[model samples]
Target: MMMRSSPFWPLFSQGIRHRVLPRSSLLTPRRTVKTLPSFSLENKTCVVTGSARGLGKEFLTAFALSGARGACIDLSQKDCEASIASIASQVQNAYPDDPVPELRAYECNATIESDVKSTWAKVVEDFGKVDVLVTAAGIVDNVEAENYEYARWRKMLDINIEQGHFVLAEEGREMLTWHNIQGSIILIASMSATICVRPQKQAAYNTSKGAVQMLAKSLATEWGPRGIRVNSLSPGYMKTDLIKGLLENEGKELVGSWERDIPMGRMAEPHELRGTIVWMASKFPTKPVNPA
Candidate 1:
């Protein structure tokens, strides 16, 4: 004969069900959802190296439009001043009712460690604290490896690695630490770091950018625990002043080849990266997400 079920069997089943399923009040409604964090950079101070022109200026302009006080660092004070003025004018025109964030020009040769340190000191003194840094100061050369000179290669690494990226990152880290601020650092790497671009023999340039990507990873590991975010932004071919001469003259055919290689059939415009720059500078990501 089958044994009779315990009288408490229904209560035991109900208890198990109660433990497994959340209470009605504890469950979130289907319509309720987490909202995206604001990408606004209001009241934040930003520093952009190589901000006089090209991709650097584009990043700076994006920061300015997002309501960040900007420090435009370049090799030429005159150029930085001019660029900042132009950015300010555009920002004013775009937001007629809103106050234009303060933008300052600081001349700093990024390839020189002393200059970078001194300039960073000034930036900290002026801005009180730096919340974001974008190292866009770098050089690219297309010399065939077979005939590449030692001096040229050394210069390429010096500008793109030693002083350009590492030194600036170190200084920025110090400033952030001193101010007890958890900040963002964006290293402007290149797609060439991972892919070999055709029609260009830039062994030195490629090596430098590869190092940059690695540097970002290394720094992220070291600084993440310190609440500092380090990431690399590897943009592909872009229509910027760095390649204006090449695109306009001898490298016209080269540009065509680059465009064909690109899935979109054209190089990117500097302004096209504006939204990306702002988002990266914002607190949304909160963690490092290096993009190649």
Candidate 2:
């Protein structure tokens, strides 16, 4: 399989969309988003795909801390349940009386329309409207570009690109008839979408994210009319199992020393990505409005 190269981006940004989208196109009389008010996630329900571990786990943590009733969905069903159990147990240990997040786990394969539909049916049955949708479900392989496995490469496209589009499309359909409420959708991309990965075979993985970047903006345009905000959150390399072996090779010289190359002087921590997810996912405020 021949893999196409990816370009750097803010795929959420439509060249001509400052007018229709929920987002402000530029600095104006109103405060910039940077200076905008922070909203609470208390009692709001959120769903995170691929929430069993890694970036998904970080998203779980962020939503939990922000007071969302979070549901962690993953193809690895058992592992997903274990993660929820562990997090719930931790909160029980740390804060006995406070309201812990109403967290649930569901086994879902985003690539399968049946799974996406059924899982979402259950999720909505449990928690009414899906104000936020975060699709982190993806897989990676380590085959050389020239010798990438045909089967693995195709499967990668199924999970990474198709699954995202399928889930987003499904969610958009549901949100359309929703009670005029606002919604947010976020897809996770990678730095590989910008820089060409090297020294290993990740052509499939890189290509998937590259495709996802554009899919997000197209959705933003279509769904913006319905008060939906769709965006992509791209991450730099992080210390996750996908790249653990590649980084941990005895003398790779990149493993524990990657901070040397990062402009911030450090490999990303699990907590680092959470802030962005939480900010974008939970956009509603919880407080009494002050009348001027």
Candidate 3:
């Protein structure tokens, strides 16, 4: 049995009512000071995995074009050298007067955590800091689910899911935190994460990309408070080394099927993603400070 409260108990006679205003009424107009940062990589240092060829090469070239120094990390030092040379020539030709930013190449197996760490350490020592990281090392297998070997599936998981989703995200975050730099991390996911390609059953590839998408979301949430922005870019079919096989083979019917679904009705060229890479590396526009 509970005892009754006295009549003099200090309860609010107004009943603690809240005045709920209409949504539109609550939106009062105010003056704001907006600071819009330029989408330029003027003084940034960018680290690009799989920078030997294909999409990685495009990213390296794009960053160089935007005035950013680049570190090309790939399995083959020779290929990395070629990529760096090409980027230097392109930048020199594009900006005849402007000094070309320094570009270095490192032989790194992105799937190996130790290799990645040492390579990043070398980069930081050489460049002072890394303002952006692009994880573009990945592979695709077109084997059917039933016929796909366990070893190949493991390889896919290791290269795609583990390297970008785990290794790069963690190591890059650590580097950013240590340098107190608000760095940008860009992971390459594929549109296959959304729609499965017909006539080609790459179950392993599709699942790995789906995992990469989720990994980006999770890393973004965890690192947002720390000023590190993690994002995933999902391009549809691109005319890169990864898809050369399908494009060259008797995939006319499959290509038609994909084209019909795409609004662009065509595969993207690797260089077309340059603008996006620049935008990602730049600081986002500041939130306006509203005046009363």
Which residue pairs in candidate 2 collide? 143-201
**Full candidate order by TM-score, most accurate first:** 1, 3, 2
TM-score of each: 0.85, 0.79, 0.82
Weakest 10 consecutive residues of candidate 3 by summed lDDT: 1-10
What order do you get sorting by lDDT, best first? 1, 3, 2
Model 2 misplacement above 4 A = 1-37, 90-95, 245-251, 256-260, 284-292
Query: Which candidate leads in lDDT?
Result: 1
lDDT of 1 by residue, 1-292 (tens): 1111111112233222101111123212222113344687767888888889999999999988777788888877668877887887888787766566767777767777677776676667656788888989888787889999999999999888876564556555675557767888888999999989889889999999999899988988888788888889999998889888665655578988888888889889999999888888888877888776
> For model 1, where is the 10-residue window of minimal lDDT?
1-10
Residue 236 CA displacement from its true place in model 2, Å: 0.5
Off by over 4 Å in 1: 1-37, 169-172
Off by more than 4 A, model 3: 1-37, 285-292
> What TM-score does candidate 2 get on C-alpha atoms?
0.79
Index of the highest-TM-score prediction = 1
Tell me the TM-score of model 3. 0.82
Clash number by candidate, in order: 0, 1, 0
